[model samples]
Every structure is written in C-alpha cells, then in structure tokens.
Target chain A: MSSDHSHLPSETELRAKALESLLVEKGLVKPEALDAIIETYQDKVGPRNGAHLVALAWTDAEFRQRLLADASAAAAEMGYFGRQGEHLKAVENTPEIHNLVVCTLCSCYPWTVLGLPPVWYKSAPYRSRAVSEPRSVLAEFGAELPEEVRIRVWDSTSEMRYLVVPMRPAGTEDWSVEQLQRLVTRNAMIGVEQALAPERLAP
Target chain B: MRGGHDLGGRQGFGPVNPEPESEEPIFHDEWERRVFALTMATGMLGQWNIDQSRHARERQHPVAYLEQSYYENWLAGTEKLLIETGLISEGELRSGAATEKCGKELRIPDAEAARKILTSGGPAAREIENPPRFAAGNEVIVKRRHTLRHTRAPDYAQGCRGLVREHHGAHIFPDANCDGEPVAHHLYSVEFPSRELWGGGAEPFDVLIDLWEPYLTLVDGNGE
Candidate 1:
C-alpha cells in the first residue's frame, strides 16, 4: 500500500472490499461461494418469475384472492417467497383508482418477482415524482387516471413491501383465460401500465 | 445522494438513480465486470474496435467510451475474483466458454415462482398482526420514534391522531434499535386531513396512511 492512498479506491471498490473483508472475518463462507450463490439465486429468482406469477393470478380468481390477502405466503406457494420476500404485500388496482409503488429511501423492492430493479425505480425522478407528482409519473407509463380518481402511491420502506395488482382491461370478452393472462406485464401489475388487451398484441 | 432506498419526492434521471454507496460486490463480479472486460480484452486483441463503435445508437455520444472504461475497470476486478475462486477455468475465459448468465433462469423463472410465493399461505393466514393494544375503529396516535436505520413508520405521521382501520401482519422491524426479531405490529388505515399532514389548506377528507400499529397512541376527545 502506498502512503499516497490519496487516490483512494472508488466507492464501488471500497464497498466491495469492505463486503469481502466482512465475509472473510465472519467466516460464513468464501467469496467465491457467495458469488456463486448470488449468481444462482439472481438467475433463478429474478423479476421474470414474478411477472409470470402475476400473469397466472390475473387469470385465476381464487389465486388472486389468496394473493391479495396474504402476498408473502401466496408468493411462496409459487416458490417466489423467501428471505428477501418474506415481508411482501400486494395492493390491488381497480377501475376506480390506481396504485404505483416506489422506494423513496433506497430501492427496497420485492426482488423475488421483479429482478434487479430497473435504473428508473431507483432514480430521483421516480422517488420524487411518484409521491408529489404521481399523476405525471403514471402518465409517463401511459396510465392516466381521472382527476377525480385518487392515486395512492405506496412508498416501500425496509419492513413493509408493496406490489401493484392492475385492473383487468376490457375488449377481451372473447379471449380465453389463458390468452387474457398473457397480457399482464410486470409494468402493468406495477400500475405503470394497464393490462394489455388481446387486440394490442394482434398482428 | 441519499441511500439507494431513500428517494421520496426527489427528482432526476428517468426513475433511475445509482446509490452513492459502492457497488454490491456480487453484482460487480458478475455482470459489470464480465461485460466490461469482454469488451476491452477484445478491443486490445485488435479484433474489436472501440472508437467507431462508441458512436453506436445506444451511446448517443462519443463520451460513452469513458463511462464504459470506468465500468470495464470494475468488471476486470470481479473477473479476477472469478478466476481466483475457480468459478470459471482459465481455458473457459480464453475460449469463450466462460458464459455469463444474463436474463437466464436460475432454477425456476421469477414469474412462475411468484405464483407459488403469493399463494403459499392461504388468505386467512396473511393478514397483518393485531397490535397488542389496539383494534379496528380504535382512536390512536402515531408514536414518535427515530434512529439511524431503515424504518417503515414515517416521522411526519408521528404524534398525529387517527383511527385504526386495519391490521397489517407482522414484518421484519426496520427500527435499528429493536431486537431484529419479526415482531407483531398492526397496519392501520390512519386518516388525516390533507390539512393535518400537510398543515395548510389540505382537503378535509383527503386523509390516508396504511400505518403500522406501533406508530400510535390512543387519542382522547380533546384531539391530543
């Protein structure tokens, strides 16, 4: 180590070193094992998994009821609930109003469903606008609620987590339950976008 | 920059903010490093070019190369870790057999896993726990608590009077001073006038908060 450690390592490097040193001190496991475990879990239990579950729940009423009532347990039934997702809750959207979730402090999200969060969820524009100017944020996602309709923005903290269950769209009367289910994207359930209609995907 | 999880009513970027804290070591080792090194090692070999490619559509500017370089340096460090840890063999890294898992399923897809996770405990069992001292329609006040840790109960709501409308289940307590156990706490649907929380010309009926039970004290008729 040079005396002119003035060119100190970047925050990223310092954090990584700190974590590595902590793990070494704890003797919990090797860095390699931790890396491999993270890789495996992140790969297996990322956001796409949650999207699929939302798609299924959208198509099933009984399951949706179970989910809204007990999100953590319901998520576990699909293998999406674990250490990170133990404190999950799903706030549903309705035709009358919409719900959009944001992490005002840090990006504390239900990683089990929505993988590594998109850069925007952790951005200043989102954290600020989602609370003060929520209507505009919703507009960015093409979800414009009526002026009279209330917009509830759930700010997730460390303990309580939130998920938005979007409303079912119209014009899918003839579509099979399975076909209608495909229209539910991760953004839709997050209240950013309304569920896509069957025609929206038509050629 | 606030912590990655602390952005409330702030603005910048398009819903994306990098935590000022150092990158999570695990992520640095895996993706950031892998992508950067692969780009650079190939650049040095003369088989790949950097300047001309820097002006690609995604870059939208020539300066992106600098950003990429910074990212590349971080990536190389993680790759070195991978090699040291035997996560990938030297031959594999050289032969392009060192596959980096991106957008790949780990075991089961997250979407599929979500279904099971959400449905695991039946509906009856998932409700928020009842606070030892309160119930629905009970008049209570938000307790004033502060510390240096992740806290779910907001400070503004402290000392505010409201009715306990619902009971959300027990969760991992974020108050750093607590025992770290998953304690039982009720989630209340506390109603405050927009005037009450905002303190100026707030809507008389515009009141809302899904507060935890611990953030409250019973309010007497005097509005204390």
Candidate 2:
C-alpha cells in the first residue's frame, strides 16, 4: 500500500508497475518468483558461462573435441543447457574461417549460456547488416579479419543458437583457466571480437 | 508476414555499434526487468508457447515494432497475450485493476519452483520416426509464399537458393506452434552465398539460416 506517486514515473514504468500489481493481487504471479527470475539471469547466467567453456576448450584438447562434436551435450557437462541454449551449435573460428551470429527475425539468443542479449545484438542495425555486410560489421566491433579468411554468418532464424568459439590467442599456452577466463569477453563468444590479447590484459 | 522484424540483408540501418561487454547493464531500467519477468512468469502458465508470444509482438505495426524499445515490445506482446488468452481483460489493463477472476485455474510458482523450471528449460526439439526430406549438401530453394500469420521463415531467404549444410533433426514447427498446434518438422541449416542473397559486390561470405522443411523445396536443375 505504498502510495508514493510523487516521483511521476514514465508511462512504461507505471504500466509495468500496474501489471505487476494486478498479477500479484490476482494470485497469478509471485513477486518473489519474479525477482528470482530476474536475479537468475542478472547474476547467475551470463557470458562467463560461455567463457568457461571457451577456456576449457582452449586448455583441454579432449574437451574441445567433444565441444565441437556435440555442443549441446558438451554444454550440459557444464550444466549450461536450457531455454534458448537447448540446441547450441558451436562454430569454431579457425585461421581460415570466422563465424558471426545474428537473429535477423528477432533477438533470438542463447540465454542459458550467454544470459540476456546485449542492446546492439537486439538492435535493428546488427540484425540487418550482419548478414549483408559482415566484414564491415566486424570492423565496427574492432575485429578486422584478412581477405583470405572466409566469414560465415549464422542467421538464427529458428530454435538453433550459434556460439562462436573464437580462436585461442597466441602466447597464452601457460595461462591458467582463471586468467584465460578473464581474457574472454562476451563479444568474443558472439564473434564480434577476438578474446582479449595477452598484452591487452596487462593492466 | 513480412514484418519489420524480418531484418536480414536489407539495407539503410547505419552501423552495429555495440557497447563494451564489461559496461553493459543486464536491465537498462527497472521496468525492463519487470516486463521481462512478467513475460516469463505469465508464459509459464501454459496458455501459449514461445512462438505465440513472438507472434504477438510480430503482429504489431511495422512502425510501432521499430519504434518501441526491446522490453516495451515485450510489454506490448504480454498485454496482447493477456487479453487474447482471457487471463486479463482489456478493461483491467487500462484501469490498472482486476475486475473479475480468471475462469481458468492459474498456478503461480514460488521462487524456488520457478528457478527449477527455468533452469531445466523446455526444449522444442522433437523426435520423429519419419526420415528427413532433404540431406546435407543438397541444394534447395526456399518456398516463395507469404502467409498472413506466424512463420519462422524469413522473407529474405524466401525463394532464395541455398545448400543444406546439416539436418538438425525434428523440431517444433513454429508456424503450427504459434497457431496453437504442436507439429514437428525437419530443420536444416542452409548456407547461401552472400552474393546469392545480396547480389555481387557483397563480400565472399556464406549466410547460414535454419529453415524448416515446409519452407523449402528441391531446386530442380531447370531453375524452377
């Protein structure tokens, strides 16, 4: 019964508040459950989960073989299989090919491993231009591949979500999983950029 | 439907300027989180599937679809689903009050229960005894037909020729799922050269899209 409407929230906020209140009042939705759902995505699930798998693949050759062979089963090993990530297909970025993922129809992303998608991933520009001008798109993200390397753009038009396994950086052979994980950014898994270079992580 | 959401290869969008991964916030604002949670929680009621929820948002006008923020689109879709499914009346939404009880029994999950369900994740992949229509490496053409309803087939890929990269097994047909009918069909990752989709001058790249069987046909040598 907090009736402090003095702040004058926006229409969107007011509507959201009203909808939440109505659902709670009708006993159709639990506020605690709603908080739990938000907290789960916000805190628990994220690109770090994908990063962990990436780091493992970089370090362990057997795990990398399993991951490339069957991504969903491999992800299940790390307990990262659910929701949008039910049918994940990892596309490895070798020296000859670069992979990029985009959901042109909508922002259909692998929420289980990568959490919620970024604003740019869901934006119209990325969706429209990713397939048509992938080289330019990659360049925009500061990832410039040479002309000889072929680019493969995965358009997520169905239930399948693509996870780009970025090429392991050079001079990181001795780095621990913890240190390697720190170098992995969310964009790297999405193929917008490569993993943080060893020199870049000096700070 | 050739809605604004079908944005692949078509131009005019400026650039893909992404925020640094470290600085990005999970929810841009409090309302976005609430709308997202509301969509998930209400979605758990089993009134509709994920495709139906997407169709609700797709049903919006092209301009409105482009203009609204991501969560705003979610709210719009949630509002539409609430009314369409008889979970809430339009009057209740406008007045910010529940006028009558929902006719159907709605079970609300507690925090722990919700977490378990979410973590478990309902997968749409179905097992079918029938053999797939097309195999990997087969060149196929996307069927060129527009239905005025929910369909996962992107307009950009329609009527375009592509090679089937792999058969992804049977999956819930989104068109049928959106229409409240659960049907399974063979899904394949079809790879079309960038030139085939956007013509010459485009980079030498292959755009791979997962297309269901119904939306594709065998490409005869005569180019029919």
Q: Candidate 2's residue-wise lDDT over B44-138, tens digit each?
A: 88899999999999999988888777788889999999999998898999998888899897777999989988988888789998889898988
Model 1 stretches astray by more than 4 angstroms:
A1-11, A14-28, A174-181, A199-203, B1-7, B10-131, B143-150, B159-163, B176-196, B199-210, B221-224
lDDT of 1 by residue, B18-130 (tens): 33212332243434433432332222222212211221211222232223323333344444443444444455445433243322122321333333333342121133434
For model 2, how does the per-residue alpha-carbon lDDT over A1-203 read when each residue is reduced to its tens digit?
01122342499899999999998888889999999999999999998899999999999999999999888899999999777888888899999999999999889888877999998988888898898899999999999899899999999989888888998899998999888988888898888898899899857
Steric clashes per prediction: 59, 0
Candidate 2 global CA lDDT score: 0.88
Top candidate when judged by TM-score against the true structure? 2
Candidates' chain A TM-scores: 0.78, 0.93
Could you give the interface RMSD of candidate 2 in angstroms? 5.1
